[model samples]
Structures are given as structure tokens and as C-alpha cells.
Target: MPEQKAADATPRRLPPGGGHRGGGWMNAGMPAERSMNFGPSARRLLGRLRPQRLHLVAVITLAVVSVALSVIGPKILGHATDIIFTGVIGRQLPAGSTAEQAVEGARAAGNDNFADMLARMDVVPGTGIDVAALARVLLLALALFLVASLLLWWQGWLLTGVVQRTVRRLRADVEDKINRLPLPYFDRQPRGELLSRVTNDIDNISQTLQQTLSQLLTSLLTVLGVVVMMFVISPLLAWVALVAVPLSVVVTQQIAKRSQRQFIAQWTHTGELNAQIEEAFTGHELVKVFGRQREVEAAFHAKNEELFRASYGAQFISGIIMPAMMFIGNLSYVVIAVVGGLRVASGTMSLGDVQAFIQYSRQFTQPLTQVAAMANLLQSGVASAERVFAVLDADEQTPDPAEPARVTRPRGRVAFEHVSFRYAPDTPLIEDLSLVAEPGHTVAIVGPTGAGKTTLVNLIMRFYELDAGRITLDGVDVTTLRRDDLRGRVGMVLQDTWLFNGTIRENIAYGRPDATEEEIMAATRATFVDRFVRSLPDGYDTVIDAEGSNVSAGEKQLITIARAFLAEPSLLILDEATSSVDTRTEVLLQRAMAALRSDRTSFVIAHRLSTIRDADLILMMEQGRIVEQGSHRDLLAARGAYHRLYQAQFSQPVADDATLEPASVAT
Candidate 1:
């Protein structure tokens, strides 16, 4: 192989979203290495919930009502405490004495402050505890709390529906984006990395929303409601309790800034590690064949370690916020308690009011702590959202023509007219190449690996648009036709056969879901699939596993051929289609293909020279250009590139007029 050819054949592994196809992995470093913009990612993630705005409003309204009711419960309980205290003091006074007499008695004892506090208590002298009033106040407090609990539960229920619906729409958008992305986008992205974005990252976003959204909303509302209630009970105590607000904000901000980066790194490493694991499992047999298990394990360990480090760093850094916030809150609580106690003792405030203030202080700090704890989850979720957004924002392939041309009576006469294309701008793969495959002709393309043989077929399918020229099917430009319209008339069988986890019959009928039983049987028989399928205990109903490990490689190939045959396309593409089958199976497939190609134009990419001896046209390509073209005998008579390739394969020279018989090529 030429140097360029060898380079093309080498498998290039890239980090997630590393480089474009022809640009190679060296063109740019790993995308995961870059730092994420936390603000924008978080905002965009919240935007996904916009569709559920009405539900969110309902949730917020419920939370506000619930928090308001909860706040009033503490105040109502404080009022009940005042009533009980007044009743106790009244019972202690002399029977039949007026409240003024009790206050004057305390003042006469040199306890003027106690007299002043007693004067404010509104106790009726000579009375026992007001049992009816106490019962009424307690009942009111209980009812308020019960209503609050019900409202809180309803709010949580609404928030759950909102979060799930938002995440569902996001998942749908990601799926649609993946389908619209160009083939080259997938080529640049590792299968595992892509899967992580679609599965793991999206799942993380869902979990983040589920865990944080309702709790954050409720916490914030509770904080606001508590502040107001504290002020109502005692403005001095409320101000003292709020001293921790700035400190808590500073702590959360500092910790979140550091942890967000680690969270991004953590998810990025997660994706990279998943890619390695997927690669290892998918190619375990290859690793064992080459005795590279140790190397594979080492690579896996390196990736795993990176993931562990990122996760540990993210957790450790974000973990500091809750404890730090709690410390500040505790300090504020102690100060407020001391101040409120002094005021109560000095007779400037009631004991019941001081008690309620303490309760409000605790309520204030608890939500702050809860919010601090949720910081980690929020950071992690936004990191995942950034990754999912990357997929949604990727550039898609050019859209099909607005007014698509139709192929009413298909004849499959594909023509490449001065077509020029490359995977990357700087590295040209095919330049100004042209070819014509007439209807009902079989064109065989033979070349060394990376000689643009596959690229030629890919162009006809319009998998990638031509950089400078146009291709046509039946004298109509393919670009003008809708991609679906063009592909529907074409059937392709690749070297690596793919079978979904389903029955063999379902796999055969994949290309034509509405295929009749007789039509399906005819296709299977024509492609030699029935011969082996009938031998299985389940016959056509035999199930192929996810990896298709249940059947032999040749059997898989036969099933794929049968699938293509069932489609009965006007244009057929067989790319090393018989390379996996045995010699006997190859002969049968060749005969079947010959019959299938009777009136349809077919392009066969093959390495075996014998396969193309009967082809209507033989193309010898080298370095993205056709070096020779003609019938096999004509190419041999010309003593050109085709002749040399044929001679090299057989290891024997041939005379100009020598007739080479077609023989089954061993896989």
C-alpha cells in the first residue's frame, strides 16, 4: 500500500468531539479539556423548562401559600403561649383582687420591671387559666399547619410533573438532533461518548431537576417567609438573625466556583471512561487474539483514575458549603438568642415573642443549609446539560431541497459529473472524479485500500455532499431529490453485516416491512439463506442476539443479502459483500447477485479479481482517480494497472488472449 493509503487505513482514536474526519486527531486537542461556562449552561438548562411555565407558576404559587401558612403557625402558637402565661399569672394573684392591685403590689416590692411585664400580660386578677381561649388558639395553629402541609405536598406533586415533562422534551430534542447530524459528526464522535451524552448526561440532568427544583423553590420561599415573621415578632432579633446572609452567600459563591469546574471535568471524564469501556468490551476478542489484555487494562485504569479524581475533587470542594453555612448560621443563632433574652428580661419584649423569634431564626437557617447542600447537585446537573447542549447545537447536514425532484420511472443510470469532495478542506480525498454506470450494467471498482473506492459509492448515495460538482440518477441531479426519495430506491449490503436483536425473519423483512411471506421466502431462497435457516430448530423464527453471536459470519452475510434482495431496488451496492462467506456460499451469492442485477445498475466494490471478470465494466482506481477502465480482457491486453493487479493476485503472467475461468474466491 502507498503511504497515504496506509495512513487512511490506520484507525484513529479521538477524544470526545475532537476533530473532523480528514483533519485527523492532531488537528485539535480534546474538547473535554476546555472549561465550561457555568452561567450560560445553567441558564440554558433552565430554558428547557419554559414549555412547562404554567405548571411552574402553579408550583410557585402553592409553595408561597404553603410557606405563608407555615409562618403564621409559629406566631399563632406564640399567641397561645401568651394566653396560658397570663392565665397562670392571674391564678397566682389574690382572689377578687383587680389587676391594678396586683401591679401595685409588685411595684411596692421594688420589682418595677416585673410589674411592668405583668401589666402588659393582660391577666384578670383572681382568675384561673383560660382553658377555652388556650384550646381555641391551639386549634387555630394546628389547622394552619395542616393546611400548610397539604399545600406543600401539592406543590411537590406539581413540580415533579413539571420536571419530568421538561426532561422528556429535552430527551426528545437530543434524539432528534442525533438523527439530523451528518455522518461526519458521528465519525468525529466516539460511539461511547455520544451514547454518554444521550444516556448518562441526560439522565444526570433529569436527576438534578428532580432532586433540586422543588426543594430549592420551597427553601427560598420559606426563607423569605421566615424573615418577615421574625421581623414581626422582634425587629432587633430579625436583624441579628439576618447577619449570616452575606456570609452564607460568600461561602456558597466561593465553593460553587471551584466545584463547578470539577463537576464539568467529572462528567467529561465519565464520558471518556465510558468510551474506553465500550471499546474494550466490543473488541475483547481482538485484544485476546493479540495478547494485549494488560495494555487494555492499563488504559482502562488510567481513564478510571481520572474519573475518580474528578468526582472526588467535585464532591470534596462542594461539600464545604453546607458545613460553612451551618457554622455562620449557628453563630447568628447564638447572638439572636442572647439579645432577645435580654429584651425579654428588661420587660421591653414578651417571653412568647422571644420564643417565636427563636423559632423563626431556626427556620431561616435550615433553608439556607438546604440550599447550600443542593449546590453540588446543581453544579453537576449543569455540567451534564452543557454536554447535552453540545449535541443539540451541532451543525446538521444540508437540508433536502424545498421542492424536491422526483424519479417517477427509475432506471438507475448514476453519473458522477466532475464531482469533487473531501472530508476536510486541506486533505482532498476525491477531486474532479467522474464515472457513468448505465442502467442494467454491473460496474466493478477495484483498488488498493483507501484508493477512494468506497468514497465513490458513498457519493452516489449522497451520504456527503459534493464539494464542487453534482451527481445524477437517471439524468436528474441527486441533490435536487429528497434524500429519502433517493435512498428508498437503493439497496446496500456492507462487508460488516448488522443484525438487530430480533428474529431472522424480521431482519430479512427490515428493508421491506410489508413484504409478503412468499416474497420473503423467494428472497431468502435466492440468496441461499433458506438452506441454513431451515436447519435451525426455529427455522425463520430463530432469534439473533444483540451482537448476532448466535449465527456464523457467513449466515449473517446471507441474511443481509436476503434483506437487500427483498427491497428490489433500482440501484444496488455490494461492498465486499461476499468477503465473510465461505467459497461455496460465495459462488451461490455470486449467482444470486447476477440474477438480482439482471436489469438494475449495480456497483460492486471488490478486492478479488475473479469476481469482476464477468462485470460489464472494470474500473482500476488509485489515489482517488481511475487509472484504468475497460473489460477484464481489454485491460489485460493493454498491459496496464488492472493487468498488473490481476497478475500480482495470481502470481502468474497471462497472455493477451488467455481466458481466465471464474472461480469461487476463499474468504
Candidate 2:
């Protein structure tokens, strides 16, 4: 919670080059308010901007007109004041002045009469402030103001619509990439860290669009318009406004640099904190059983403290930007005031012009402050953008080939021909090992803890590519087939089955999205989960808590097995699949596995020797090699590695079942 703000705020600075792990060189750029630090790269945000072009064009057009009207409003008021002192009021009209001039003269007379009634009046020479003139000028200004407001409102509405659409696409794309990302990607990142990148980072960008972009755009346009007005009013004085520009720029650059560093730290710290929280929660049971509560708490406290410090540091630096800008803006106002007043007093510039100049100065500063405020958001947005871009930029594995050869759904004949593998370059997990599972065959893999039993299943699934060999299904190389197509034909019931936060029916239905309720129940009966499920309050509709925490471990396994049964894949994989429940559940799972394997190519890796005693081919693996292979009865007769392993597992007295955990139970 202490880091919530930083985690939520969206930092703009990222490790340069979107480093996969180690931080890299950072490019210097403005703090995030206006657009991305790099103008061209920032244009990417503008790509989405075009969708609201009509509304945005109206908004900008109104802004320009409003600024022009405000800049001239003061001049009109000053001119009317001066006119009261001229022939319109004090001086009689020249003998043959035109009738229109006479009418203006009459209006001035009325204004002077009203002015005299109100004692404090130093009128200028040509204000033209008669009732009709006054009404016309005020109405014009009001119209312009209303137009500006309407445009801004419309633009805001447009921005919200765009934010929702952009975030939706960004999140979906990131999630899809995560799913397809090579497994090596996960080896380099914590899951929590990647989650922060895809979720928190994208959310930050959305917040920026909602709150900060308007300020940035307005400030920029104001500065531009006011600069033109300043030049028209008084060339020499216009230079003074320009002077503040550079000063503001330099200070902003420094602020941006410091803030970027803090933001990067904040993001990094937030990711670390989330990582700690997830890890701690995942292992909470382990901590309690081992009585390590104090240790875990102390570690969490340390991470929490770091998170608070990082957040506070990031916020403090970003917060200073607005006030500093305001101070500089106020200083510019003072300079413009003094210089314009002197020009008017010397008669070098008209009073009306000086008045306009002063209004222009304030207009320029307001946007300057806006641009400044925008810097904070700009910084934060760029940070989020960079992270999001980094993910999109990741060198994804070579995509599946286009125009790949196609065949009907697989008939489940698998072969590994001289297949050799290693996770890292120097370490081999499997070497030159060839095996096959023709249809309707049960191949069981037995090995010591470090043996590559699981690796074989992964390769068969093509989760990792083969090295120095080829794997084929029905004589078609797996690599030649579409990844989804290949995997769809394979169904795996991994040891740690994950259940979504949904009902029993939904979870079973997930394996085959179109499965009917009757089919789901049939799967449940096949997997021996129906009796227990029927006893639950809502049967199949019962809501599971986070990670199926509401259910007992045995029950979760049964439901998971039922899901696999529902899938009815051509190739079935049991990767120590029953290693996390009681003996009763283990027996149910074995029966379920038996029923499902009847008409498929099943690859099961077994820990309990009893489970694989009837396997068609039992292979004993040591390190990465298959040292022996045969039927269970055949291996037992050979009395080699498989024989010794089987004897060691089963020779124990049945009494040891009380002390030893069941085959379905795991850490």
C-alpha cells in the first residue's frame, strides 16, 4: 500500500534501450508533458490523435480565436476610455465631421457623463465606449469564450474515448505477446515485473491522456499566439517575453532530468515490491510450516520501506515542477508590466496597445505554467510508453511460417529421431535420445529427481524447440505445423494445474469451450469427481476463490483431471500430474488416466512405481539419457536401473504409507 501511488502514477523514465534486465544508456529529452521526449517518436501518440481530428481541429480553432479576442478585449476598453476625453466627450466635434463620426461623438459624450457621475476617471483618447459599442465588444468576447470552453469539453470527451480504445488494444496485445513469448523470456523476468509492465504501465498512460494533455496543448498554443501579438504591439517589449522562454527551458530541462531518475527508481521499486508480495503469498504455507514468519515479515518490511522512499522521492520532485513554473511566469508578468507602462507613458506606444501587450503577457504565462504542469504528465507518460513499447519491441521468437502445410487433426503418432537438447549451451538435459509413441500406447518415463523426464514432454509439446534433431507427429515435423494447431492436438495435465476463478462447470468447460453441461458431468464421472462435486452447495456453479483456494487440494486435482478428460486430446501428457493430493485422489486420478489413455498416445512421467507397472513401455532416464526401456514386466525381469528404481519405490512396507506422503502430494 505504501508504494501504491508510485505503482499507480506511471513513471516516464525507463532504463534506456528497454534493457531486458540490466539498465542501459538513457536519451536526454524533455519532461513528459507535451509529447514524448523525442518529437518523432512522440508522434506515435499522435497517430491515435487523428481519430479525433474533427473535434480536435474545432478545439484548436476555437482556442486561437478565443486568445485573439482576449488579447484585443483590453485594447477596446482602453480605447473607449481615451475616446471619452477626445471630441466624443470633451472636445466639440469639428464643424463638418461625418454623421457616423457624430454618432460616435454622441456615444463618447454619454460615457463621459457616466464617468463624471463616477468620480474616478482618467479617460484615454479613442475608446469608443458608447452603450452600443460596449455591448458589441462584450458580446464578441463572450462568444469567443464560450467557443473555447465548448471545444475543450469536446476534446476532453474525445480523449476519453480514445484512451479506452488504446488501453484495450495495448493490454490485449501485451497479453498475447506474453503467451507467445519464448520461455526464455520468463527466465529473465519475474512474472510480477512483467505484469507491472503490461498493466500498471499502460494504465499510467491512460491517466495522462485524461488529465494532462489539455494543459500541454493550451500552453503551447497560447505562447505561439501571444508571441505574435507581442510583436505587433511593441517589438522591443516582445523581446522581454522571449527572454523568459530560454530561462524556463533550461530550468525545465534540469527538473526533467532529476525527475526522470526518480521515476525510474519508483517504477523499479514498485515492481520489486509486487514481486515480494506475490512470492510471499505463494509460499505462505511453507513459511508457517517451517516457522519462518519473522523472517518473511522482516523481508517484507524492508521492501515496503524501500517502496515508500522511492514513491516519496518520485512524487516530491515531480510536484516541484508546477510551482517553479508559476514563479517564473509571475516574474515575466512583472517585467512585461514595467516595460509596457514605460512605453505608454513616453507615448511611444498607445495606451490601448500597452493594455493589449499586458494581456498578451499573462496569456503567454498561463500556458507556460500549463506546459510546465504538463511536463509531469509528459514525463510519466513517456515512462509508461517506453515500457509498453519495450514489450512490443521485444525480439519475439520467429513467427510461425506463413503458408505452412496443413493436414487433418493428428492421429497421435509421435517420434523423436536423434533428438538432442540442452537448456543452456554447455549443459545438456537430453542427448541423441529417440523415442516413439504410436497410437494407443502408454509410454511412462521414470527417473531420479534431476533426470530430464519433464523435458521430454515439453519438447513433444514444442514449448521449446528441439536441438540437433527433429520431432514429428504422423510423419509431419512439428515445426512445420502451426503452433496452436500442434498444441491443440496435445493435452497436458501438468502437476501444478491452475484453476481459473470460476465455477466447477466453467473450469471443466474450459478444456473444450463448447462442451455441454451433460458432457461436463460425464467427464466428472469419468474422473471420479462427480460424487464430491454433487455434495458442494451449488454443484458445478460454486465460485472458486483466488487460485481455487476455497477447495481442498484433492478436490482441485479431481476437477483438473476432469478438465483434461473433457479435452480428449489425441496426445495426453501427465507430468507428475497426480503429485499433490491424498492416496484416494491418487487412485481416482490413475483410474481417470487409465480411462483417458485407452485411445490416445499418452506420455506420463510417474514418481510412484505402482502407477506405471502396466505401462506399455517404461523408460528409466539418468541425467539426460534413456539408459533402459521396456514393458514394466520386462524391465523388472532385466533388473537394471528400472528394476532397481521399481524395487526401491515399492519394497517399502505398506506401513511406511503413514510416514510417507501420497504420490499425489507435493511441495
Candidate 3:
């Protein structure tokens, strides 16, 4: 009953030779090649944000204001210095004061006692300090500091909305894409890589986008404004600060290239690690059965180490970015301080001008630091963008003709002509196989494994395009008909019946939601699922967890059949319909199948000959070609491939028929 503990606690038994090796992987040393193909997906990635432009506007405004506040805060401090300090110049306060004495004298003139005294005293224009003016300037500086604080908070608040909404929408788009994509896309992609794009990449982008976009834009504005202000104060000092720009750009470009390459590898290795973990846990039964615990752990360790190396390498290169910008920024400040000091000492510049130059130099460097950090985020985001778009670029399974003339319902008569397919150019999996299932009849296909049996169904379902063939329903070419229309008509009961984690009623209702509860009960009763399900405390309302692990394989199979019965399609394709069930249950399923197929056309691929013993036609196939065709009794009498296979499957003298008679076996 507890398959997890029962399976894990025991030793693992792998299938011989090709299962798990000493390290739990048959090909443990498979070369690690995690290459990404990056191209013009940047524009496309930006378009993914179309729905959230309003949030972008709000975020950008905050960014601009926040940068202005921070950049001007120091500049205001510099201005305050000029207003408060009176230097020794040719212009002096009417000779009642020294340069230091003039500043002290002005401070006393600012207030009630001071202003009245200053107004009463004799002070000349351009040579005197006004204490009242200095106080007013200091008040303005205080207001600038307060504004800067508010801007930072505003930036944070605006960014929160952008990050949460954009990330939610982006995740939703990926999820929607997953549902829209044809099944074949999943066949080629590792689940781990796809998962990494959704979880890790999107999460990184959300955290970085609102903040980094703000930082980068604000930094650019600050740098430009400061550079202009620097020239206003002194062109020579501004030039010294500008010297690092070209070098920083070139170095950052190099870092972007290296980090991009490493990030691609990092995500790939992360995917491989996840894939290994999923495979290890899912097939843990196999691992433990063969006593492969040590080997499994060791394989996992190897994958983890590879991921660590790749991630460490990527972050290490990206990490250099901050220090590089800071190095240039610090040097720029020293140059400004030295040059401005020299100019002021030589009397070529006023003390106020020198102070302004230092302020502008800082303004130039701070934004540059912010921009450099933003560049790092940009590189990683771009890498993820490329990966996500790669998925979008892969050709979807083209739906059959769009806007085609409608056929309200399909009368299932399927024909395959000269059908051939090869997944790769050289490895032919299906050959020129011709087949037909007439309306209102069941055609059974039985052959050895890899005889193109499932491939036939896949082609019928249009999971993959055929290399050369024409498959038709009734008189219409299937490719010319809409895919959904065709799928809607055909009912499939896969070899592995998957029941999602929902109520038994919900699972059955998937095929037709409009079907009433009474219809669902009727379908279940028709398939005999009602027998076992009713035995439980809850009948149709009982929940099935993770493919109905609580129910036996036979019960799950019957529930799936009930779903098919509810769809009530004109055709049913059953692949290994009875393999997982016991002999008695198979008899029960066969009884249900008789009523299901009485009026509909059915194509069956079966290994259990008993279920298909009375089919109107049976096709015997080998190596992608059907070698025999006839009714079951007629084929058994012919002594050909069908005869041999039928005998081979049931050679044990029926294992005593009375015990296996299965009361009320229909047909």
C-alpha cells in the first residue's frame, strides 16, 4: 500500500547491462556540452511586457526623481559651504573685519539681534557676507536632503508593483505557452531547463528589472548632468574625471561577453542536476531494487559538482564588475580633489567654484558605478531572454488548416496510405505502412515491440509529422482538417492511464465538462468503474492523488475507459488496453468494450490476444510493415505471423479455463 517506503527501503534491481552502472548511470562520462544559441530575441523579450507599460511609467518616474535627489544632495552641501564661509578676497567687508572675522561677523548679523545690527552697520556690496542669506541657503539644503529621502522611498514603492505584476504575467505567459505547445516540443527539451527558465530566470529578472532599470537610467542622467556641471565649474577638472569612461565601457563589454557564455552554461548544468534528481527519485524503485544506493548518491554528487563549477565561474566573472567601476570612481575623485585644490590655491578659481567641481566629480562617478552594476543585471537578463525565446522559436506542431470548413462530427473511417516516418534522417521508425479501419468496426494491430505500433497511433494523433504519407478520415485529408477537430473526434486510452490529482468525477468530466453528473455516473457504470469506486466511502466524489496511486492499476484503467465512454467518440484507439489488469479484470474490461465499440470505429493495438480475438480485422506487423491481415479465427488458421504471435502469447494450455472463466464475460 505504501509504495514509496516499500520501494525505497529495499535494494534496487536494475534491468541487466543498460540500466544503472557503478555510478547509477550507464553512460556516466557522457560529455558535458551545454551550449546555447543566442540571437535577436531581445526585442521579443521586451514585447512580453506589453501588458504592464503603466507600471513601467510609474517605476521610471521614481527612478528619475530618486537619482536627482541623491546626485544633488552632495552638490547642495557644497553650495552651503560657499554661502556659510567667507574667504579672503580683494573684495572685503568694509575693513571692519579679517577674512575669518567677516564670516563670524555675518553669522551675528543673520538673526533678530544680528540682522538689526547688520542693517544698522555699514557693509559694502561684493565685499560683505550676509548672514541672513546664508541661513536661507542652509534651509534650502535641508529641504533637498528631505526630498532625496522621499525619492528613495518612492522608488522602492513603485518598483514593488512593477516587479510583482511583471513577474506574475511573465510566469503566466510561460505557463500558457506550455499548454499551447504541441507535445513534441517537450520530447526534445529536458524538463529541468524549461523549469529553470520559469523559476530561476524569471525570479532573477523580476528582482533585477525594476531596480536595475531605475538604477541604470538614473545613473546615466546623473552622469550626464554632473559632467555638464563639472565643465561649468572647470573644464580641466571635468576632463580628468572623463578619462575613465571609454576604458570602463570597453572593460564592461568584455565582462558581458564572458558572463553571458558562463551563465548559459550555468543554467544548463543546473538543469542537468535537476533532471538527474527527478530521474533518480522517480526511478528510485529501480535504483533500490538493484542495491544501487551508493551508486545513485555518487552520480548525484557528480552532477551537483558540475553545476557548482559552472555557477561559481559565472558569478566570479560577473562579480568583477563592481570593483572595476569603483576603482575608476575612486581615482576620479582623487583627480578632482587635487586639481580643484591647485586651482583655488593659485587664485585662478574661487573656493565656491572648487567646491562645486568636487561635487560634480562625485556626481559623475556615482551614476557610473550604478550603471556598471546595472550592466551586470542586463547581461544575465539577456542570457535568460535568449533561452526563453529559443523555446518560442521552435516550430509548433502546425494545427491542421485554420478556418477550414467545419464538419460538426466525424464518422470514423480512417485510412493510412504509403505512411513512412523517421525521427532522424537515417533511423527509420515507420515505413510505408498501409492500413484501414472501416466505419463501425474494430481493427486490431498486434506485433512485436518496436513494430511501429505506437508510432502508428502517434501519426494518427498527429504528434509528429510523417515523412511521406496521407492519412484521412472518411473522405477528407486529416492535414487539411483542424487539429482540434480531429483530436476531438478520436478517443485514446494510453498504455499508461494518467489521472490528475482531482476528484474521480472531475477526471471523467475532463472529456466533456458540460456532461451532467448523471452522464458521468452513467459512463462510469458502463465501464464498470462504479463497482469498485462505490465500494469506497465516497463514490464519484473520491479524490485520486497523483495518477490515482491509491487505486489498483485495474481501477485506474477502468476510470480512463469511463472517460473515453463519456466522450462517446466515433472512434477509439486503445494501446495495450488490458496489459496492466489481471485476467478477471481484463474480462470485465472486455465486457465494457463490447458496448463501447458496437457503433463506433475502433483501432486497437494490443498484446493481449483475448481482448481483440473477435475483431473484424487484425493486422500483423513486423519492422514497420504489416505482413498479415485477416479475421482472428481466419489468421489463426493461416499459420503465418499472426498465427505464430497468437500461439506464442497463449501457449500454456489456457492455464485451466474454469478458474479463469470470469463469470458473465460478454462477447
Q: What's the lDDT for all of these models?
A: 0.84, 0.69, 0.70
When sorted by TM-score, best at the front, the candidate numbers are 1, 3, 2
Over 288-328, each residue of candidate 1 has an lDDT whose tens digit, in order, gives: 99998987777677767778888999999999999998899
List, residue by residue over 1-667, the lDDT tens digit for candidate 3. 1111121111233221112221223333444444444335455556666677887777667666766666666556665566544422314455645444544566666534333333333344346456677677778777877886787678677767766777787788778777668754564444555676678777776766766766766677778777777777678888898998887888887887787777776665565565567667767888899999898788778767766876787888977887998998888788778887776655466566678777777677777777777765666676666656555566666655656655545678899999987655666666887878888998998777656677777777776678898888886777877788878888988777889999899999889989987999899888888888889888778999984778898888888889999999877988877777888878877878878999999988887787898899998877677889999989989987776676556766565544331210110
Write down the TM-score of every candidate: 0.93, 0.83, 0.83
Off by over 4 Å in 1: 1-31, 126-128, 652-667
| lDDT (C-alpha) at residue 42 in model 1 | 86
Candidate 1 backbone overlaps, count: 0
| Candidate 1 positional error at 621, Å | 1.0
Pairwise lDDT winner, candidates 2 and 3? 3
Candidate 3 has its poorest 10 consecutive residues by lDDT at: 1-10
Global local distance difference test of model 3? 0.70
Model 1: which ten-residue window has the lowest total lDDT?
Answer: 1-10
